[model samples]
Target: MLVPSKIQTMFAAFYVCLVFWCLDSAAGAELAPPRNVTMVTLNTQYTLCWDWDHTGNVTFTTQHIARYKLNSKKKSPIWSTVCKDILDRSCDLTLLNLYYLGIHVLRVRASVNGRHSDWVQKEFSPDKDAALGPPTNVILTPAGSDLEVTIFDPLSSNNSSMKELIPTLAYHIMYWERSVDSQASQTHQTLTSSINIVILPNLKPWTWYCVIVQSRYDYYNKGSNFTSPHCMQTEGATPWWEIFLYFLGSLVTCFLVMFPSVYSSFWCYKTLKATLFPSHQLPMHFKEFFGTSPGSDVPCLLTPESESELLCDNVTVRLEPAILEVHDLPPENLPAPLLGLKPGSSAQHSRHDSSSSGDSGVYSTGGRSNSQQPNTSQPIAGVIDCWNGLDAEQVKMQEMALVLNSRPKIPADEGIVDMCV
Candidate 1:
């Protein structure tokens, strides 16, 4: 049992030394130098950034000294620690109040657990290293064949106003007619800083034009990309040929719209006049009876027959057997379309047909070709008599029923109706 206990103690000592070696190796690997030290400048601001390999929390330290100070052999190179123990990999050094156009060297190192890595260094100049950005959301308006363009400045990655931070920022605008090739188009440019608007004068009216704008900082020699082309049509006075075309189109449209209405109203008026007041000549004998004697100067007021008289137009219907014969023929035997039908074959077959053909209730669409409809002859006798004694008998019957007051009336076969009054 004593030998077994001694072996166990020796094994515990070996395990402790192995753990110490591993911890030391891990510490050495973690304290490696930061990679890719870079200096970035935007306008008057300066930033120092670096890349690191390890994960988890880390702190960085940044130092900068003027390039001229490094070249002086007599002066001691003093690198002030502008950023100390920062969690972020990038550091903003604008607060240090360094000269913007002056060249400077920047260095960064990683720190964890009181251990430091070797410094990684880079050189930067605010005048040459800064990047420029383009204007955004360009707008164009037409001022009577002239175009007015408005430019708005761009924003930084954090959406802050980058133009306000840049004092020397200016804009360059170019415009040309759309009909010409962009490479060969007539264009002009001028630097504008105070105002965001520019005008292009004397463009052709009703013509299209394109515009593009870019921002630049002349002092820093930084220029951004140009914006996308914005094309718009210009407005101006009207041309004579165009006005004539518009007038012609309006005249044709109005005629097409009003023609149907005019024709329909005229047709309605003619039809109504013919139906309400049929035109017929007075009989010659009747005209002579009502006329004054050729030599007399007396008015008809003293005439005996004109004093009290009931005047009515006498009409005589002269329906022929040939018309009846023509009406009774079958549709197939009538005729083909647009050709006249002369009926003679069915004349002797039926006399009963002539008797009933005058009634309106017996009307039919037959007696015409299958390929076409039969024409309805105008100046129709039936339509002329429609408002005459057509409904007189029925109206008289209604009046008689009203007088009876629901009492039973004598049948027509009795030849008499007793009066209530």
Candidate 2:
């Protein structure tokens, strides 16, 4: 009985030890897998990363491993290890041999001691995943009435290897006017070769437009997120030449409107200046001779008989003797006596007097007697004869002198004349 009891106790202790070991092993295999796994690219290099969950009260001694397989193949895929026994949650996958345009399945697992958690799997394509990055150096420029947009390809760490994955790239563009009642429009364009320039036409002139762009591969309908909104304005419809012409026309119109008024003002100013300050005046000698006062009057005692005798001092003729001689003439010779001539001086006059002696003696200056009279009988007969023989200019000068001499002049005082004498 003692021996049997000993065997049973031994069995019970062994079984309990086995059961605890199994429970520890199972618990070790239940470590949480990597969370939030993501792929990041940086210029011909690729990296995989994940989050470490340390949220529970239980502590874990954890390590990571990453593996990949081609999803396109039907046969059992051979999984290649990207990283093993790594303390870091991230692994570099740039050294892995990848196929062009191949759909890939990637997995990451966390291990505690010798046991691993369930795998966290992700499906990836280098073409689609690499294009998730936004394009670089996007710019907008004005091209006449249109808008020109330029963008470079999105940067990728595995660009060289992924080039064959997406042989062609397509661009999706979205644009709209920045107005209250504007609607956005979209356009898609495919390019076999990389061309950074694009022209958008039929835009409103001088209007502000906002635009965004994204890239995608032809095989994959998925595209990258649109870039940050870029805003620019379209150029105006009017040409520079037409604007210059309008400015020139305005200048001409202004000149035309102002020229006449300017000229008229200048002319009026000149006339006013001339009227206010006269440039010419009469000589001082003439002013003194004419007397300063315009209304002065003086008595005249001298009568001039001819232009040459205007300023004579001596005067001995007697008007009474001449009148007495004129009254002595006979009534039959009265007509001839009035002309200061004796009767019967000529046969023509003597015949006229004899015929008119029996009739009343009525003298007529325009009769035949007057016509036949000699020019020497008048007081100024010699002067008249000399004037008639002169030229027209000399005749005019002589007549002007006679008129000036015939004016009544103020006589000098008798005492002053006597003193001169």
Candidate 3:
């Protein structure tokens, strides 16, 4: 119903009224500046905090903003925002550009609907206000008779608070023997960089020790609180007496293990030697009677019957033929004449005996019949032909061979011997 220009002018006046109402509302709702601004170091991070007045009846929708500037006089101070839209009362300083050993000014304020409160400012030095944090990843281990400790600096990272402030770090180590009424010992070591590991030497062996570590900034002269106490034990040194006993036990064990083999080898060697090179000496009485001369003759005693005549008068005849029974003969005894006969001759004699046994009244060389004629014209020798060219050892061996071959084998159940022809 209104004209176009009138309508346009009315809309513009309404817009201006709305704008002024917004400005007045914003001015009335402006937030109060934060108070008691403080900076504190926690672990490896720096935090800024301030107190807010929540006691007023007026309700305000507010947010906090933090900014920092370097405390340099010549350089144009350009403030850098640390954090924005912060509903909490604290802001982390790790997000800011920190300068080492340089002064800084930090400001924080509250904002409500684009209207800002007065900024609360504080001056601080990175070195003076910076606090070192406790060492992390602390470990203790035994190093022979000593103790080895390893730790990592909390401020060694790029985002740490004290990294720029502290040029060098020093460690204070406190240790004591874990016993009643024992005094504690302290050691100090300054390192240009992070101390990754350290060794405490000259410690008591096989002893328990309690230890604690703390770190300090060289420029700030502030030290962190001591870490949790750690307990460790050093390895024991082996005693000389125990080492000697161990050696002796080893030697005894080796001897016990090798003794059986050594003894068995010695016995085997002795047996082989005896078999290969046996003693060849006769008895004392026989030694005197048997001469060593090559051609010397020795009289041998013989057994004969009354009808038997000795061709040599120097030979003695102590045994009677009746006393020399076949059963009484030695197991090694063989026919005396067969020793000089060849295999062919012996076989021929055997065939002749088999063919003319009744008429010839003879037998094989192994034995003779009673009707066989004796060779009285033949001279009796002391030793038989079987032993003529052989030594005593050879003769013994030959006798053993014959005995083994001709020996009678008895059955397990039968006691009587079975003589083999």
Candidate 4:
């Protein structure tokens, strides 16, 4: 193909222009400023800090690390102060008064020309490191049956952006009743308020109360009376359960001391009645026993002769033997007779009687007299023989249809028998 020389030369020039434009754009991109540079006030003397990065071989001076505090209006530049050599760092301002009080606005500008870079205005306060004077705007509120009061730092007004501006306080709340002369006593009533300084005014109910909120740091509130009125009342009196518990304890102690003997006596009586009187049904002699006069049922103790007389029912023996064998008698079989003898009777009787009759082979006399012997104590052989003899006598009496023998034996010396011729 045949190309014109003018066309080739124009093409070559256009290509050179394109290459230069590309190179220039790359250089411009490399020279762009760092983004989001910021300034922070660390304290009263500290004005501002930066959050910035270096680019394209810029020296620290060229990066404009020092922050300048401009005029309040921010129109004029006070001298550009160098805080540090780092591009991302804090700056100390020589103009300390500018940040001493009130809110301060600081702007950090980056300028290599000393003409002051565009100002980055930031608003902040100085570090409150100094000892706080005292609390102000103190308030007292009445909590239920208690007094509560609080004191706030005066500087807390503007530092709302910062945290925890409440002042550290050493305060006490005291109350005193006014005397007749309007004088207050030093020995006043006191209450412990909550730790929080904001809620300090409260008291017990039904009392005329007042509170004095005082701090050791020379803080004062002149407008306050320095003593809050007593607002006091007592909670309800002690509970009924406590009184009941006290009485119940006393009653239990008394019962513990007395109940054992009483219970034991009752138990013994019931056991004796149940054992000795096994017949639950009333006795046939109940009417007679209950109706009889006193002493009618007096217990009787009789001698053997008397018992024999009663048993024999008017049958008189010529001679009543005195010696009675008692060896065969069990202890229980011993009769109630001869018991409870007076000392005089014991001295005269020697507790036994001698017998005139000789000993029978079937029964041995144990040197005991029937007069002194127990009525129930008798030899088994004698008892059995007596029972048989009585049985035979009963048969004879039944045949005779009489209670006595026909001869009825008259006194031997007094009678003479007449013989029939």
Best by lDDT: 1
Any runs in candidate 3 off by more than 4 Å, and if so which? Answer: 1-31, 42-44, 55-78, 113-115, 157-165, 180-196, 239-421
lDDT of every model, 2 decimals:
0.66, 0.58, 0.61, 0.42
Residue 132 in model 2: shift from native, Å? 2.8
Question: Using Cα atoms with residue i matched to residue i, what is each candidate's TM-score against the true structure?
Answer: 0.40, 0.40, 0.42, 0.26
Cα lDDT tens digits, model 3, 82-145, are 7776677788876554654566677887776566677777876655786667777579899999
Tens digit of lDDT per residue, candidate 4, span 152-226? 433333443112432333445566543445554544755443253534233345454445554332233211223
lDDT of 2 by residue, 104-148 (tens): 677887776566667887765564564354566579999977889
- Point out the higher-scoring one by TM-score: 3 or 4: 3
**Best of the two (2, 3) by TM-score:** 3
Give the backbone clash total of model 2: 4
Model 1, residue 262: distance off in Å is: 45
- Residue 221, candidate 2: Cα error in Å is 1.0
Kindly give the number of clashing pairs for every candidate: 0, 4, 0, 36
Give the runs in model 4 whose Cα sits over 4 Å from its true position.
Answer: 1-5, 24-31, 34-50, 53-78, 89-95, 99-105, 109-199, 203-421
